[model samples]
Target chain A: MNEIKIFSPATVANVSCGFDVMGFCLDTVGDEMVIRKVDKKGIVITKVEGFDLPLETELNVAGVSAIAMYNAIEVDFGFEIEIYKNIKPGSGIGSSAASAVGSVFGMNELLGRPFNKTQLTEFAIKGEALASKCEHADNLAPALFGGFTLVKSVSPLQVLEIPTPEDLYATIIHPQIEIKTSESRAVLPKEVKLSNAIEQWANLGSLVHALHTSDYDLIKSALKDVIIEPHRSKLIPLFNEAKSSAIDAGALGCGISGSGPSIFSLSKGLDVANNVKANFENVYADLVIDYDIHISKINTKGVKIIG
Target chain B: MNEIKIFSPATVANVSCGFDVMGFCLDTVGDEMVIRKVDKKGIVITKVEGFDLPLETELNVAGVSAIAMYNAIEVDFGFEIEIYKNIKPGSGIGSSAASAVGSVFGMNELLGRPFNKTQLTEFAIKGEALASKCEHADNLAPALFGGFTLVKSVSPLQVLEIPTPEDLYATIIHPQIEIKTSESRAVLPKEVKLSNAIEQWANLGSLVHALHTSDYDLIKSALKDVIIEPHRSKLIPLFNEAKSSAIDAGALGCGISGSGPSIFSLSKGLDVANNVKANFENVYADLVIDYDIHISKINTKGVKIIG
Candidate 1:
């Protein structure tokens, strides 16, 4: 049977230092899609569930990505996909990337694996562009390939797989609110001081080195986000306080995940991650808004065949 | 018999993509210093040669760095240093850094190796501050540690050693012209577009990853310097044609070495480096000004105790 189900993990873009170039996957949250072959020559969206996203093939990422893949392959085959998105859109944790990646990942398998992971990512980017105006691969690269990924350049479509330390844990807090990606991006300064930019580049270089070497102290020193965070942190309530609390609770570094309404803290171990989660809970204790806290290791596998 | 001689190699800072954050040593040109213990508690510069640099202990980097190291030790001991400078001053190949690194490296040896390399780098930065207002280590760190070096952070003084591939070679062209570092810096824009800054950061992060993984193609793609070169290249004569010639001649990437007057090209093999050197020579052949060409492997051993 030419049918398969693909599960695409939720991804975190920006990753603190790299604004539009860095991303990583999380195993705890994801989206699933079931794809099957048809006798026709176009993509068909059978169902869209878990959110009020569009069902039209041109509007939805799942259908749009499948169509993009079909266009690239130019084959006389059709695909029908059922989308089951779990990550909420506008949560700043790469919600659309899951749907976009799942579609092409499932379709590629249904077509006898016609495209590589990188090629699938390109089609997924087309889907992401259909939904979002920006043509970024930070989320798409991680969602398609799993683990940590660096989209060094998008034109030639170069994606690098970064090594993740086994003991490193990620703790995320998603507040029940919405901060549109466009609005979050619009608030950033059009011009940045060259001195600050130099510092940022230095930190990004250091962070990459730390990730490869598994140096905990270097990670802490290099986790700072001076440019984007200073402007975007205004969108989230108690972002600085929560970050401070997480650091006080033994977290290595903490910052806003993606744009806002969701914050993440990276810790050295399970005990520290759990303690940092408790600290986050303390910061939002009296708040009336609902929130959820999830703790897990960095996902090493991106999209996988489930059934 | 507490006497030592240290050879500190010339270094290329900025490395095209990482302005003020990256640097590497050259195997061909360098500075040598001779240091010996004295009976008193004050450092002295017994000899200064090669260039018109100051011989006064507080005026020259060799003497200033030696005094800085002596003060840090706070021991009832003194040292006398003799400088045999080979790297031309203001040539953009870390002329001052070679002197500064050599002084502390030699003093540490005479003091029975009191400080580690990192501690020695701190004293060397103080030496650099004596000549230049900015306490930069882009050149000094690599001069002391050898190989490719990253000045991760200057506040607490963190320098990281980046891995180098075996086949990597460097080609340098030092046109006999003077472009002061301050004037080169002054020509740059005080603020850069956020988009350009993001691109620069992405490139820097990619360059570090490429160096670690030895991905030569990625290095070539990420070696674009959009911020400083566009402004500073105007000061250098025949900059673009030489760069184009080197690239066409098989150099992986080429750019201004530090501030100006000296330019470097990185190539995959020794043959390519030599050919790129010839290409640069051809570009400058029509010019009436005197120029020098140097082709060498990356100096992985930074500074060494020569005698």
Candidate 2:
């Protein structure tokens, strides 16, 4: 396949109890990309649509990630890329990750799958680092491997694909406010109470077990964040109200997705997910802030060919 | 079933990355107890053997736990308990937990099993608090529910029983040194680095996932302690050497079992577990320190009726 068209899904990172390590893919929201092998010797971004992101190879996440992948292998011909962005940058829904994963996924497909998903993740994070300002695999892993992912360690780049329950769905509400990743990280304390840390890890452990067993009640109980959310949620408008509304509308759990301005609620079924979305919409409707809301099933396929 | 004699299993809590939350039962190392109903008004420790322990109801963990259970229930009669101790106190194994669990379990059995294991754990922790100076279900949950357990929460207590892989075994080496629970706890920092906390939770989440899927390699990778072990291991003699020897002998992972002095290693099979035990024996043999070592399969049944 000399030319490839692929849909790269968006992702939710720092999933409540699983801060800095866990994430899940969203099926309905993503970025579409088209790539073609050319006789050129270097990576190039031919076009970017729907968002005025940087087109320069060094500045754009997609270009940077593709360059990382390209430099690692001996490819005589280079690739030209076109990105159709749907996920807003800094929406707290892994916008950069979608772009980063899209380019490498397409390249790997064109190269007859030379690299594995883990290697693709490694390449993708190089681009992701430009956005997050550090190497983190929580978003990149899910965007590549799909479903739920737990980044066991960043240094070793170990990512474990946790099972996604069939009925699980996510409702996301993105309030039109920019919370820069660096700024969001700044609000967090360098140290956390050891007791709270223990509670957080216990919740994380149980949440992982709940996912494997498909135990909704356990999931409800386990999806708590005692560390990062308290500090970061202050930056988001009506964060508590949105979370409460979603939970009251039958979401299993609700929390600030990634660094915020976006809040995510997980529910067991599509109907509940829709209910959560409606509640989120209601939460933002009275406010002057512009917002976007979506309901999505768990995406089992990360980045896949569309044409 | 008015009177019963039972064997209560020992447990290794704080399993590597799972400090303050996780534990598993041991098959061969435990304590024995006999509990019988009487028309008396309150819990009574009728006899004590195999070790010098408090026979007073309030001072004895079994009696304290039995009283807790007794106070919660509408029992017409009190209970008599006789102890035959096997697990050594302050060995970093669940010695107090066995006694605490034994009384409540026997009472529940004699009463036609009115309280569930979770409720029994609630009563058991009342006694465990006497030993550890806090209510922790890590050891009690495993000693009651058997196999592996994660105490997700201490307040409004929630315990999750994790599946034990059929081939899994534990090798425990107890060095004859005293590390009081309070002293061990005092060694831990009140706060930890947020980065380290994230790493710990990630390992714990992955460890729980590994247990559910029976992934040995994942377990091996996930069984890491980055938070509490650094401070607590200093209290244990030859902690680093013992861990290295265990890993060198094919153990999946090794760390301070509960607090200090005792170290536990997990392996995939009986042969490797035995090898780990032998290596542990070798580590302490050349030194002047006396040590005890035992290898046992994962105990799926916790406290059980013996006669």
Candidate 3:
């Protein structure tokens, strides 16, 4: 009998000012992937729950990841992968990333962990590229390094593991609305105003410094996006109102989760996190509020195997 | 007899990615202000030099800075300020910043150093506000800090002083051409595509990481600007050739200096700096090369009193 393995962890991509260059793993609300060696020289995937995901080699997130990893290393191993999808897809919770990352991570362990974190991240990106049609490291960094990670550079893939502050709490509210990555991406303009770009860089620079020095106030002030958020927010109904409520309820910063419909907030304490979660609930009363409020700390461990 | 007083070093506003929010002071270039107390309770301008400068309060950089400072702080003391400008006006080398910063520094000393670096920087920003008609901190931070400084936040005006690596050499080539800040500002688009913004953020994040770790290769890779440099490059004659020459001569990175007309290159050693300078000289033989080929070290000391 083949053994069953599982790897799961939540992830936040496009972290506040970092946009595509930063992300982090959370202790809860992630996807689990189980892989077992098969006799045949081909890959197979089973999507178990939460997301109505596809099972085809190219369409399935886990299958794509497994195939990319195997092909990149020229491995002829056949494997059957199962994605126990916990995080809702299109919820800005890195749902797809969890599957992709989990598959790569589990397979890497099954294959004796031949690749490093970067190599794993690259494999994860290949999966993401198939889904999003663009290679981005935002989700991959956190899924690999764990905790609060900065994808400092994508090509040659540099990941910096930022020290997560002790008082930090994340309050994630999923509004159960679908905002496809492609559609969310379409609303944004092809060119950004120089003024907006300057502000973005300024905020991003401050955000990096804040993360490095653990300056909470700087983080609060720098959690602004004049570039992508404004247009992307328009796609999500009551997005601005939800964000405003979170801020008023004592969030250090709040923005659309991943790409939208799901919103996340960083706060100083559990009380603030609760307040922020309640605020989001209050604002979007009509929507299905799946409150995954976590006073939980950053996940220093990303994807890991469970037997 | 008139009292001799020295002023703050003029700064290069917007150190590439840190536009409007980041700046650094240069030791070699600045403006000098000599202030002697007079019987009248109003600022009296004695002389202004270094390019055809305007002495009128609204039009003059130093005059506007002095006016803003006096108005804000309600200083009743009158003094004669003679400006000995080393940084040429409209040279994209923060010539106007030097004047404004010089005025603030000179006045602060004349007022018995009543303000700290932060306070002086705020006062200097009055100068920047007057010159650019926009409140920006990039030039002021460098003028006040005197090194590769990062403006972490502009509103509460937080600045982080980054240590410049010892092995770094800066080769600045002033082509003697003029590109007005207004024109440069106008040429850039108001809206950038989401993809381009992502790339910009990626590069910017990498650059910050590079700066922190002193990773020269990462810095070289991260110095790319897909947003402003390309559009602004058109205005600067032989910009492409100069950049190529500088890079071929062993510079780590090359880009437009501040706005344009002046281009700078980051190199590893004195040999590289000399080689870069020689290359620039060879390429643009007719244009008088103002090669500021100096060892690139972080300016630890910002503005100081010199008698």
DockQ, each predicted model: 0.88, 0.93, 0.52
lDDT of 1 by residue, A173-237 (tens): 99888787678878999999998999989989988888888899998888888889999999998
What is the per-candidate TM-score for chain B? 0.97, 0.98, 0.89
**True-structure Cα RMSD, model 2:** 1.4
In candidate 2, stretches whose alpha carbon ends up further than 4 angstroms from where it belongs are B39-41
DockQ of 2: 0.93
Candidate 2 chain A TM-score vs. reference chain A: 0.99
Local accuracy of candidate 2 as per-residue lDDT tens digits, B117-198: 9999999999998877888888999999999999988889999989998999999999998887678878999999998998
Docking quality tier of model 1: high
Which CAPRI quality tier does the interface of model 2 achieve?
A: high
The better-scoring model by DockQ among 2 and 3 is 2
Model 3, B163-201: lDDT tens per residue? 566677677777777677789888877777766777777
Q: In candidate 2, what are the lDDT values of residues A112-197, reduced to their tens digit?
A: 99999999999999999998888988889999999999999878889999999899999999999988767897899999999899
Best by DockQ: 2
Predictions ranked by DockQ, top down? 2, 1, 3
All candidates' lDDT scores?
0.88, 0.92, 0.74
